[model samples]
Target: MKAGSWSRLAAACLWLATAGCSARRSEPISKAELLTDKPSERGRVVFMEHCNRCHPGGEAGLGPALNHKPLPNFVKRYMVRRGIGSMPAFPQQLINDSDLKDLMSYLTALKRHERGADQTALEEINSRR
Candidate 1:
């Protein structure tokens, strides 16, 4: 082929190759899908669906003891939406907003109960001492 024809062919091939490169990459998961309301029961459901496979309920399993850590609301929410360390990112579709909220609330409540139990034990110890 002539030089001009070669150049045109090369340009067309390059354009086709670039177009076929697959630009439809996965989108970043949104935080809004994660539930962030108070008393997050739905959030707990979300947790069970995505997290329970790895982490145990109110106990440590594939993951660490989530209840053991007395994390604040924002931290919990962030972790749930963004995931942490070994945890996988669960997008809004996987865990809707209400579910995230419920999950956080349930975890916090579990933590609270644990603290109360610890306090009661300490009181007993003090009384005996």
Candidate 2:
């Protein structure tokens, strides 16, 4: 085949491969409804589907604990969308406006729970002494 033909063929193949890959994961993630007006349940689905893989239970997994530091919301938001350190950036498409709102709720709730759990565990351990 001519050089031009080869390049065209390669481009076509690459496009097909990318399209196929995206199609496999294209099924929209059904977001869970917020149980209340509170932001607490807002980001649960997005968090579970994406963030949980790295930040299991919003605690340290492959990624560090999101709440342990309690940094500013903008900072966290920027870091998550833009990525920081080892954590990967989560584009708006994967986490739309609604998903991001709910995710903030999930993260906030997770932080409070983690704090409580930590205190409880410490108390229990001390009691054993």
Candidate 3:
């Protein structure tokens, strides 16, 4: 290959690398971390503003109640980023990767906590035997 061609290829490679380096990878958020006030609150606000249009608190509206079993990480992220059915995609500007992770964690934590509460109640009743 000619020197000029090689130089052009190198420049292209460098540009691609620099661009990739600046792009942020989505990090997995911990359930405990999201349950906290900061990220959780941000997520909650984002949900209410964007999702509440379709999904009501408990009762179903345009969409099903999201209070069900905590969705798998992929599903949650997909729903937020890609949107399902009639849902609209939440852009990264509105909800970044961290925000999405935190929201998913918070929602899942809520579901798990409810399940634990129910189990405790069941155990108490069984102990009466």
Candidate 4:
């Protein structure tokens, strides 16, 4: 091949490699890192089994990030049941009402922890001023 063609191919390969590296995702939460309460623990299991693939650690993967969304629990529940856009609907057979409730609890706890971390960082920055 011509030198120009070889250089262009090398640049494309380099770009693809870097792009993949940037897309590397965070690790999934472990059992040891359970947020709080028994419900959250149970919900964590449910989330790992069902939701983790698309929403790893509640962060965006194949789907949008759940951690930062300010949606209500009921809305989230409805979306899980009915689905929207690329997300598939999860029926009662897959996740019963009780498990769903537990999942919500886990999600709430995760959001709370995330918010607390953000607030703490902001407070620290302000204090340093």
Candidate 5:
């Protein structure tokens, strides 16, 4: 093969590799999807603005996965109010009581949805057998 042809092929391979990596990244939630319940929707917005960076879609990223965490609401609330480990504390000013309640609602809903999905998949597999 020509030298130029080999260089072009290398460049194409590099581009394809980068493109694949970028495609694997999760996309941001859309506003329409957030319009489920008033409080939950608001909570979703708050999460995107504040918590999404570390906990993308409640899955672990920079921090632990919150969706699967078995912590109680009060414990979660306390953690938010008074930081834990690498997690930063979010005072009342950053997230008020009302917003916190909404956030909890969203988190609960997220956990339920994830569990439902897992259950559904399991049921499907069992049915196949």
Candidate 6:
């Protein structure tokens, strides 16, 4: 991954470490906050507002959820810029480069946190024996 991606990924890791500890993880995240919050929070919020209707939490909906697994930065950039099949392209006008970076970062961090959660759960289960 590129350095920018790594940094975003790091930020996301930090977010998970801190944010996951709260009860808010169970609370729903709103789309309006995505645009109004600090810069770092924009990506997921932008996605929820624009992309979530079609793809929720990276699961398959009308379209595919980005979080199903890890995807390359370039691939995502291309897909959004160029569009594929039934999906439509998102030009720079609609989503600036910076926002795209945030989106990728959000997706990567989301997956890592999920893996971490799964591991913690598994460890807890195994420890019971």
Q: What is the lDDT of every predicted structure here? A: 0.56, 0.56, 0.54, 0.70, 0.67, 0.58
Task: Write down the worst ten-residue block by lDDT for model 1.
Answer: 23-32
Taking all chains together, each candidate's TM-score versus the true structure is: 0.54, 0.63, 0.53, 0.66, 0.65, 0.58
Model 5: per-residue lDDT, tens digit, 1-129? 975455446544543554311111122321122224788888988889889999888776797667655556776787788676677899989999999999988887675554344545566679999
Per-prediction CA RMSD (Å): 19.8, 15.8, 15.5, 13.2, 15.8, 9.9
Candidate 1's displacement at residue 1, Å, is 55
Per-residue lDDT of model 3, residues 29-80, tens digit only: 1112224466666666766677767764322477655554334567567657
For model 1 the local lDDT of residue 119 reads 50
Residue 81 lDDT (model 1): 69
Q: Highest TM-score: which candidate?
A: 4
Poorest 10 consecutive residues by lDDT, candidate 3: 22-31
Ranking by TM-score: 4, 5, 2, 6, 1, 3
Best candidate, lDDT: 4
Tens digit of lDDT per residue, candidate 4, span 24-87?
Answer: 1223222124357999889989999999999888777897677755567877887788776677
On lDDT, who's better, 3 or 5?
5
Residue lDDT tens for model 1, 14-80 = 4355432221111121111232345666556666678767765545567655555534676667666
Name the runs in model 2 displaced over 4 angstroms. 1-38
**Residue pairs with backbone overlap in model 4:** none
Worst 10 residues of 2 by lDDT: 21-30
Which regions of candidate 6 are displaced past 4 Å?
1-40, 116-129
Candidate 1's C-alpha runs over 4 A off are 1-41, 115-129
